[model samples]
Target chain A: MKKRGIGIGSIFYGTGYGNGFPDVSKAVAQLKSDGKIAIYVGATEVGQGAKTALSQIAAEVLGLSVDDIVFINEDTSITPDSGTAAASRQTYNTGNAIKLACEKLKRDILEVAKDYLGLNSIVGLTLKNGYVYPKTLPEKRVSLGEISESLESSLKEEAVFTAQTTEMDEETGQGAPYWPYTFSACGVEVEVDTETGRVEIIRAVLAQDVGRAINPELIEGQIDGGFAMGAGYALYEDLKIEKGKIKNNSFTNYLIPTSLDMPDIEKVIIEDPESTAPYGAKGIGEPVMIPVAPAILNAIYDAVGVRMTEIPVTPEKLLKAIKEKEMTYNEGKN
Target chain B: MKKIKLTVNKKEYMLEIKEDTRLIDLLRDVLGFTGVKEGCGEGECGACTVIMDGDIVNSCLVLAFQADGKEIITIEGVESEEEIHPIQQAFLDVGAVQCGFCTPGMILSAKALLDKNPSPTREEIRAAISGNLCRCTGYNKIVDAIERAALYLKRGK
Candidate 1:
């Protein structure tokens, strides 16, 4: 016989290393003569779409499309230090740096465009589609190609942003350690096999507070990937260690969820907006996986009346718990 | 050491190899098809997947000598210089390539499946690429990319 139950889990996570720790990230934006914008930073992209999101941020700031921003990253010698790509800080930290650099570049371009357009006041002027022109005057526009020809060399702007945080008192162990916090909630449905203690996830639904979604598709990808990892953590990704040496260290022993292992997933994106974050967007790289394990565990308890404290919730452990519960009931009746 | 003749990406190569050399090493190190990534180096992760004689096999598990007189299709040969393969294009348009370590094998698996079926249901597509391990995008977009690729292939675009 198989019993089914649904469980819910929620969490609030603070992105970036906080607690009065100085968190800084840097970026340099160069306006190429060909009218392409090159963004230089040291943020590593491990397939989490940091480069795409960062480029979107730059594009948002400079009134350019994502295609116009030539995103360059992960080179230490050429690009400046953008810190490590941890704590979900790349979007929040380095994104701000890129935003600032593009803003400066925009100002410089407008300065040159004012002279090219023969405008005394550069107030009504803006950049769009490789042209610098007044908002009202579409006819009196100068292309970026013409703007670059008048310049002696290409224009560049470098900027840096420090995350705001304060150290806590040692005794109290409290302070404003992290900024731009994010929250998420998850619901999971599972079927627990009473005969063999097998558990299967039927469906999963998650609602994430992503401050703002710079790239909605990328966010969807992140949430889906996070759920797979969380499912693995809740089910069967156990690493064996002996004498501090790891056994089952490779994929042959350790396993992750394949496409067949995943259930139907529904993602709900909540965009409340963070004022301090770039384009009012927060980092969700690490927070999306926080709710999956607890929800699955709770669902298992609901179905089979077993509160599995350990991960993997293997059949052996679940069956032992069920047998013990049955014995306690049978003995008490006598 | 042994001598083997194989067709890779429609190119014929007659090469001498050690009896112990795996096809992955031959494709990556010797043939310089670095697109054939070796993730697990074992048969579990299908990162070294290549199409051999119309079947998808883990190149890491296949010895170089086993490929003698066989036809192999790798990521490098998926498209011509002028146009990208529809599957690769769909992977890009759907934003399925993340970290991209598992892409070469994943794409080859999709290619083999489409070459056989041309119009696979979502479940069949899932079953086809289940051996490839991608920790980045989960499997949602990759699955969607394959479905989209099927549309492109059916339309003969």
Candidate 2:
């Protein structure tokens, strides 16, 4: 017999630095001769699209295409100390720093444009498409390239952003862990075969409150990748250790999800913008993986009427659980 | 040591290599093709997949002696001088590449499938690259890329 079930899970907000103590710094420089903008930050891109996402943030601030901005990241010799790439903190911490630095750069450039154009005040002057012009007088504008040529030196600015959080009390062992939280929920449908104890995930619907999606496509990629990892964690992946020695260290025994093992996934991105985040965008890296295992487990319980407490609910474990449950039911009837 | 003559990426190389040396070591260490990554150093992960005489095989599993007189194609050989292959382009267009570690093997698997059957169903695409493990983009985008590449190849785009 085949049975179907559904389950749900959630994640709290977390920054990489515990209690949000570390400060992330970013530097933005506009080249004098070429008028190109360069952003430097110490955030690594581990398949998370940090280079693309941060570039998009910088491009949005500078009013230029992403291709025009050069990003130097994760190079300790060149980039500043923006902090580690874990806990989904780079998008929030480094993003804010880059945004602030770009704002300062724009202000400095507008000052130059103000004096050159003989504008009364800085108000109503906006930068768009590499040009600075007054709101009403579009014709009276100066190109950023032209301004750079006249200045004869590059314009540079840097900023640092630190998130606020309270330390834990020693006696109580309680404290505010994160400044802002990223929430996510996942619902999964699973089909369980009673005879073989093999469960197949049919569909998964995941919803994340991402604050704002700097790049929507990238967010979807994160969600899909996260679900895959979660599915592996729930069904197949296990490190068989004996006497503190890893028995299954190779991929031949330790199974990760393949393309055939993945189910149909529907991602729902929720944009409840965070006031503290840059462009109202928060971190979604780690949050995407938190809720997946529990949802799959819950679905298994709903389908086979057995509560599985261990990770990687393998076929053997499920079969044992089913037998035990059946034995208990028989004893109760007697 | 035995002398083996192999054609890799259309280049002929005749070298004396150890009999026990895996094809992965030969291609990466001797031939300097770093695109073939070794995730597991075993046949399970399929990261070191290469086309050997029109058959996709794991380089880590095949011995250097086994590849003698065989025509092999690595990731470096997939593209021409001026433009990228349609499979690579489709992977890029569909955002299938992330850390890009598994991209070469994944692309080659897709290429092998397309060579066999130009227009494949979604299920077939998934089954074709099932051996290639990518931890980053999931298989969704990768499958999408292969499907898109099939269309591109069908239209000669």
Q: All models: lDDT?
A: 0.91, 0.88
Native-vs-model 2 lDDT? 0.88
Candidate 1's DockQ: 0.76
* Shift of residue A140 alpha carbon in model 1, Å: 1.9
Per-model TM-score versus the true fold = 0.96, 0.95
In candidate 1, which residue pairs clash?
A: A18-A177, A19-A177, A20-A167, A47-B99
Which TM-score value belongs to model 1? 0.96
- Give each prediction's root-mean-square deviation over alpha carbons: 1.6, 1.9
lDDT tens per residue, model 2, A273-333? 9998998999898789889999999999999889999989998999899999999999999
Off by over 4 Å in 1: none
Per-residue CA lDDT of model 1 for B23-48, tens digit only, reads 99999999999999888888888999
Report clashes for each candidate as comma-separated counts.
4, 2
